[model samples]
Target: MTSTSDLWTIRPAQARDTDILADIYLRVRRTTFLWVDPGKFHSEDFVGQTPGERVFVCEDRNGTIAGFMTLWEPDDFIHMLYILPEFQGRGAGKALLAALPEWPNRRYRLKCLVKNTRAIAFYRSLGFAIIGDGSSPEGDYKDMQLSGN
Candidate 1:
């Protein structure tokens, strides 16, 4: 499905968009996950990790891809949502979330690294609450969930 929010256009990931999306994935992770070893994240990791998951990409008014999100349908898990640093704070993440099928009527869950306070706050603003906490190889994390409307 296609969705538009302000100047951002959100749509399903097309085959042609994979390379750019993977690059964004690598770049965002390297920059955002500062506590993790940057070398551990590779562009190909996006391709490998996203199989069987539904993926979507958001583009700016000029048609440049600015971010992407991935969802594991079976469990309603928001596996990843990343926007290019240059395009952040424009509601691309929220647009991507809304583009999900049956959004706001379907529960969602995601793990946010405890150190990423900005992300935690963002999620909280979207109505996600920390339901549990745990540690990952990168650092401690909080398991957050948002109930359906």
Candidate 2:
């Protein structure tokens, strides 16, 4: 597998990418949510929500799907971000984030599992601040937001 920092392109997802994206989503979720119910992966719910948001995919030089993210542009909410385990820490997440269309005076917000310290740290490094906390069927989570500035 290529490093996430290696040459990769970000593009709008297409119907053809459904399976690949699903696989990445499941794999990443299972790995990250071990503290929760692994059997409740909810792969369908994850894939089903893609159509409602702006989905972007990160592809490697070989055209392999490495990761993906979903953004609700209207609300400036980052719905999901998942990178294959092999591709994590390779800058794929950062690249996917960079691909989000920029808007003036728009703050972005997202909820991340509280147990996902690495992801929380990553978001914090990108200037996101913890604003609150919440709970879901999966587990406890922290609300994080990034300033428009």
Candidate 3:
């Protein structure tokens, strides 16, 4: 991705950002992890209790929640990275992608639903290469492992 300030600021999520963070939880949750084993993702309780794992809202000039990304360092996997549908392709996600390294791994890993072709391509463009494929806990979902700098 390229560098551009565009329309947002990056910051740690605070307790006050609780509502917005919850929104992220609701918007994300099973939808993205439907292809990962249940054990790899955080438990529902962490949504409100784990502040360190979260990044707050990236608002546009008008102040809307463009989206946010959260990290779970133990496994080198980005727990969640989401941009509201309206905010997609406007640098929000890319900016968040660029920010991932701040969490510490130069080579990070994340799994994506194999059926989400759009996400697969987006991750590929960001230099994520495939490392593996498997089924989720349900044994019904197709998943792909992605790794990149």
Candidate 4:
């Protein structure tokens, strides 16, 4: 997708944002993860994400942290996509999800808690298909895919 006006400026995360991101992750851990997350993660546990993962945060015009989403490369896994409850429906989730797939891979996949019907519907609305199921040692979440392939 071509860059929009950057109404929400998107930038590469820095060390400073790490604390903020981790905190947000903690605050909304359940809203996003949905699976059997062990508990609130330590800030340091969020350091690198994964080798090919790309994480981004969105700040409203006022500069408050709104939310964040992550995409893992090659597979373009929808690692996380969440907007603060206060920021929900304002397009933060859509924006962050849209911003992923800079290279536009053929197959994209993500997992959502089996109980989060809302999330499942949202993903379906965006054209993802439930392909399989996955267990994270945490629990089983429905695996979804949208493959340009």
Taking all chains together, each candidate's TM-score versus the true structure is 0.96, 0.90, 0.70, 0.78
Best by TM-score: 1
RMSD value for candidate 1? 1.0
lDDT of 4 by residue, 2-95 (tens): 2233556444566688788877766676555555564645555556563456777787778787878777776668787766788877777666
Query: Model 4, residue 80: what's the lDDT?
Result: 76
Give the candidate order by descending lDDT. Answer: 1, 2, 4, 3
Q: What is the Å distance of residue 136 in model 1 from its true position?
A: 1.6
For candidate 1, the clash count comes to: 0
Better candidate number, 1 or 4, judged by TM-score: 1
Model 2, residue pairs in steric clash: 5-90
What would the per-residue lDDT of candidate 2 be over residues 1-149, giving only the tens digit for each residue?
11244578888888898888887888788888888777877667666776679888898889888899899988889999999988889888888887776732357899999889999999999888999999988789999998667
Ranking by TM-score: 1, 2, 4, 3
lDDT of candidate 4 at residue 148, scale 0 to 100: 57
Evaluate all candidate structures by whole-model CA lDDT and list the values in order.
0.92, 0.83, 0.62, 0.69
TM-score of 3: 0.70
Error of 2 at 52 (Å): 1.5
Candidate 2 lDDT for residue 114: 89
Candidate 4 RMSD computed on C-alpha atoms after optimal superposition onto the true structure = 3.2
How badly does each model clash, as a count of residue pairs?
0, 1, 0, 0
Overall local distance difference test of candidate 4: 0.69
